[model samples]
Target: MVQLNLVKVLLLSNERTGDVRYEIFSKEGENPDYPEKIIVYREGNIGEHGERG
Candidate 1:
């Protein structure tokens, strides 16, 4: 039997807009399909600072 565990870390943060960024890492290189690290973004706003509808 084999087990896999993933770790997530906060890469970036924004206080004003409640935006966040995260990174996923495979410490043991468990999965061949994925690299050592993966990036993810969680946006609080629809557009960037200047862009608006």
Candidate 2:
């Protein structure tokens, strides 16, 4: 068995037409078969600034 520690997660964020998109990926060389670790989060009109959702 083997475990690859999540040393760091690179966050990529973008906002377009009031829509926010986020992508998460592990640092390079920290893990193999990285395509299996890609995560994407999406949201639309989450808030009106200074708000938490």
Candidate 3:
């Protein structure tokens, strides 16, 4: 698989209200099945009103 470059990973929120987004980052070569130790990052909480929380 190709290595992810951009830290931001756009995705539909579980709420499914609208275009909510987040960012994820992990160490290079880290396996999801056997991750020894990895770091993660998530950003923002936008509501229907389009405000950061």
The TM-score measured for candidate 3 stands at: 0.27
Show the lowest summed lDDT stretch of 10 residues, model 1: 44-53
Instruction: Estimate, for each residue in 1-53, the C-alpha lDDT of model 2 and write its tens digit.
Output: 43434443554444544333434444555654453354545544557773434
lDDT assessment of candidate 2: 0.46
Q: TM-scores for all candidates?
A: 0.37, 0.30, 0.27
TM-score of 2: 0.30
Return whichever of 1 and 2 wins on TM-score.
1
Give each model's clash number: 0, 0, 0
Residues 1-53, model 1: lDDT tens digits? 44444566665656556556766766464763464667777665556664422
User: CA lDDT, every prediction?
Assistant: 0.59, 0.46, 0.47
Native-to-model Cα distance after best TM-score fit, residue 49 in candidate 3, in Å: 12
Question: Which numbered prediction scores highest in lDDT against the true structure?
Answer: 1
Deviation of model 2 at 46, angstroms: 12
